[model samples]
Every structure is written in C-alpha cells, then in structure tokens.
Target chain A: MRVLGIDPGLTRCGVGVVEGSIGRPLSLVDVGVVRTSTELHVAHRLRELEVGLEEWLDRTRPDAVAVERVFSRSAVSTVMGTAQASGVAMLVAARRGLPVALHTPSEVKAAVTGNGRADKAQVGAMVARLLRLDAVPKPADAADSLALAICHVWRGGASDRIAAALEKQVAARTRGVRP
Target chain B: MRVLGIDPGLTRCGVGVVEGSIGRPLSLVDVGVVRTSTELHVAHRLRELEVGLEEWLDRTRPDAVAVERVFSRSAVSTVMGTAQASGVAMLVAARRGLPVALHTPSEVKAAVTGNGRADKAQVGAMVARLLRLDAVPKPADAADSLALAICHVWRGGASDRIAAALEKQVAARTRGVRP
Candidate 1:
C-alpha cells in the first residue's frame, strides 16, 4: 500500500509519500514543502496554499492521506491560519476520494521516535534512519513530513506487511478447503 | 460595502451576507447554508466546503469576509474538523484577495446582542431586527454566520473603503501642514 502524510502549519506544510509491498518495510517515495508568503494578505496566502496543495495531490495521488492534527495555540491568528491550512489539505485528499487519518503531534512523534517526548531533531534522525534515507530530511518541515509518513506506515502495518500476509493466508486457507 | 460571515463546521456551517454603507447600519444581503455528509471522510467534507464557499464567493463577491475564530474544543475530532472547515473559508477569500477577519463566538454574540452572554436564540432575534428581516436565520448556523459578520463590521470597520478614506485624510493633512 502507498501512503501520504502531511504536517500542516500556517505558513508551511510538509508532505511525504511512501510505498511498500508485503513482507518488506515501507520506503520513502518523495517529500516536499508547501510554503506561503506572510507579506501578502491573509486570504491570498491561503489561496497560494490551496493551489500548491492541489498541485501536489495531482502529482502524488496516494491511496491514503494522514495529517497531523490541530493543536491548541495561544494566539488566535496563528491558530486560525493553521486550521485553514489543514482544511485545504483535507479538501484536496477528499476530492481525490482518498481515505484520511489525523494523528496528533505527540502521536506522530511517539511513532517515529519511540518516545513521545522526542524533540524535532531527534524525530528527524529517527525518521531518516527508519526510512533508510541517504541523509536526514532538511529543514524541520521535510523531516516532520517524513515522520508523519512513518507514523502512517506503522499504523497501517507497513513494517510487518500485515495486509499482504493476511491476503496470502486467506488464499492458502481457501485452497486447502477446496482440496 | 457588502460583507459575508462564515462559521465553518463538519456537519453544519452558518453563512450570512450583509450589505452596508458608511454611517448606516448593515442590512441583510442574503442568508443561507451549506452542509456535508457525516459519513464522508473528513478530507472529503473539506472539499465539499471548499466548493460551497467558492460558489458563495462567486455569487456574492463580498467586499470582505468574516469568520468565527475557532475556539479550543475538548473533543479532538471536532476541533480538527472545525479547523479544516475554517481553513476552506479563509482560502476562498484569500484566493480572491479579499480581506478576511476573524471573531470569537462570544464577540459575535455580544456585537449582535448587547451582551456577550447571549445565546443563539437571542442573537438570532437581534439579527432579525437589526437587518429588519422578516424572520430569523434558520438552523443555528445561518444565525451564527450573521452574528460573525456583524462582529466584523463593528470591529473591522468597512476596511476596504475605510482604508482609502484614512489614506486620503493623511495625504491632505500632511500636504497642508507641510505648506
């Protein structure tokens, strides 16, 4: 199964895609960032993000989308913008008829680092190591995106290839009964 | 200037559009709604919201957009979805280069009614009288949308025209004083 993960923010969003088959771990397919300018009006900035997200979705077309859930913010401005960004992301995936799951920041961190208290750099290193990447994803956004993908893989049993193995078991059982 | 307010949610979103001029109270331009399937994936719901907001924008071309600030929610799922819906709304206004302002639910209620402690029904009745509409907005969402719009108008001012007026005042005063 192929999975896409998104880490949403007001000014920047991180996205990562991975693909895997049964009995093998998921491999990193691609990663990128969606950025918006604060210098522009709030609405225009949102439009830029919407357009960018749509463009990314068109190219990737993953089977599933997993996003980092919204968190509490002291500033209403930041909270509002972040919420809007997440919404646009959900909209894109939905338009494609893909399934979406939202994971909290702690959940993504815990899945990637094996410890919920892990920091950004720690999480980034873990993501790079787990994915067997050439190097750690640059900037926090890319690494975070990678981490989201990692979380999805774990949840979806990418490490164990449960879906594929389960398919094989059912097939064998059916065959035995026929004989 | 005409302004529209939106209170985005997964199951229900309130919408109200009011047209107003300088030195006069706002009048109802239109009031309506847009809803999404509860069974649909959250991301798909956001897409529906985007399309709904887009159509609203195209038809109204509101001079400004007002949205309720997303407050903290105890339910994780609800918070996440509400945030997404708000995002879709902001994106619509941003795409059009229109100014978007946000207000808290209490602020909207206070602005519409004389008290921030007012409930939905109180706000609805006040909105009906303020706009001189024959009936109160239906299904809660529409009324809340109107409240948000009223809040923005009271606080944000007629931003599009007011900004120009301020600029002209500054220019004239600066020129005469320099001479």
Candidate 2:
C-alpha cells in the first residue's frame, strides 16, 4: 500500500509518500514541503495549504494518509497552527475516501528507530536506511513525515482495517444499500 | 455592514449574523449552531462543518466573518478542536472572498458589555439588549457568537479596511490587473 505522510505546520508542511506494507521493503515515492507565506492572512495561508495538499493527493493517489498528531504540550504559539494544518490534511484525505491515520511523534520515532525518544538525526538516519536513500531527507519535517508513513505502514494494521470498514459501512448506508 | 460570527467548536459550532454599522442599532439576522456528532471521525466532522458554514454563508451573504480567536491555554482536550474549527470557518469565508476577522473572547466581552472580563451572562444580556431581542440566544455558544458579531461591528474599523484593501490587491494581482 502507498501512504502519504504529512508533518503538518502552517508555514512549512512536510509531505512524503512511501510505497510499501508490513514485512516488505519500503520505497520512497516523493518528499517535499508545502510552504506558505507568513505575510499572508491565516485564512489565505490555509487556502494555499489546501491547494498544495490537493495537488499532492492528485499526483500521488496514495491509498492512505498519515499525519503527525499534534499535542497541546507544544509551544503555545505553534501548536494551534500545527493542529489546523493537520485538520486540513485529514479533511483532504477523507474527502477522497482515503483512510487517514494520526501518529504521535514518539510513535513514529519508535516505529522507525526502535527508540521512542530518538532524536531528529537518529530518525532521519533510520528513514534513509529503510528507504534505501543515500541521504536523509532535508528539512527535519520531510524526514519526520517519512517516519510517520513508515510507522503507519508498520502499525496501521488494525486501525486501517477499522477505518476502511467504517467507510464502507457509511457509504453503504448513504446509498440506501444497507439498513 | 453585516457580519457572521462563529464560536468555533468540534461538536457544536455557534453561528450568528448581525446587520448594522458601528454606531447604529444592530439587528439579528440569524442565530443557530452547526453540530456534528462526536461519533463521526474528526475529518468527517470538519467536512460537515464546512458544509454547514457554506450554507450559512449562502443564506446570509454577510459582508464579513467574525470568528473567536483560539488560544492554547484552554483545556488541552478541546483547544485543538477549537483551533481546527476556527481554521475551517476562516477558510470558508476567505474562499468566498469575504473579509474575516478574529475577535478574542475578552475583546468580544468588552465590545458588547463595556467590560473585558464580563461574564458570559453579562455579555449575553448586552447582546440581547443591543439587538433588541426579547431573550438571550439559547445555548451559550449562540450568545457568544452574537457577541462576537456585535464586537466586530463596533470595532472592526481599521482592521476591516486593511483586510479589504489587502484582498483587493491580491485579487488584482491574481488577475494580472496590476503593475
């Protein structure tokens, strides 16, 4: 399965696509950051993010999406923006009938590096090794996004199935095909 | 001028529309809440909010949108959802080319009741009195939304003009109509 991972942020949202599943070799499809101008109004910046995310979705057509789960414990100034960006990413994926998973930073680190407290360099190194890339993705956000995708591929088993089942049930009910 | 005010939340988003200028008597155009089931996925809930806000915009066609500014100091469990909802509200308005303003809670209270620290009841009572309503709008969220709209009417002066000017410049640039 192919997964698009997003490290959501207001000014620079990191995005990476990984193609693989559990117990298989993972390959990197693409990695980049969607940047928005700080000078723009928050509303306009969000609109720009939506446009950028839509373009990525259209280009990659990933089967699922993985986004970093934001926590309120972060810096007060940045947590809100992170949450807003994450919400937009999830909305875009759900709109396309794709299952979206949220992975905590620690969860992603543990999945990729076997250490929940792994630092940025360790996570980046592991991602590079796993994806067979010669170098770690630039911009910590990019590497973190890849780690999120890898985590989802490794730990998405039950959650992914449940989401898929729920989607199908909802669709069936909407079509009046099920009671 | 007319303004649509939103009290952003995950489960119940309060919305209010008011018609009047800074000094003139304000009248309530509409008041209600947009609700999404807690059982629904966060992504779907956001999409539902988008649809609900769109409907309100289509019906009210307000000159501006006012949304409560989200702060991270609130309950950790709810602040993220609030920020996400606020983002969606701003996006809907911006997408429609409408000027959007964010009013802090204290600002709304001060504008409506002459006290920044006024309690909810005080703010609600003033909203009713100013709008000439027989009773405060039901649901605290509804009253808060109306208060926000009232605040924007009274204080949207310089900020409103700036937003309008910026929007025009952006639109002109988009159309290649400017040097």
| Candidate 2 lDDT tens digits, B9-37 | 98999999999996688999999999976
lDDT of 2 at B70: 91
Worst 10 residues of 1 chain B by lDDT: B170-179
lDDT of 2 by residue, A1-179 (tens): 99999999999899999999888899999999999778777877776787789889889989999999888877668888888888888877766668888899999999999999999999999999999999999999999999999999899878878777766654443332110
What is the alpha-carbon lDDT for the whole of candidate 1? 0.72
The alpha-carbon deviation from the true structure for residue A17 of candidate 2, after best TM-score superposition, in angstroms, is: 0.5
| Number of colliding residue pairs in each model | 5, 0
Put down candidate 1 lDDT per residue, A1-179, tens digits, no spaces. Answer: 67788888767888888776445676888898888766555555666666677666777877777788776643454775777677777766655555667788888889878898899889988888888987888778878987887787668555224433433433332232210
Worst 10 residues of 2 chain B by lDDT: B170-179
- Candidate topping DockQ: 2
TM-score of 2: 0.94
- Once model 1 is optimally superposed onto the true structure by TM-score, how far is the C-alpha of residue B38 displaced, in angstroms? 2.1
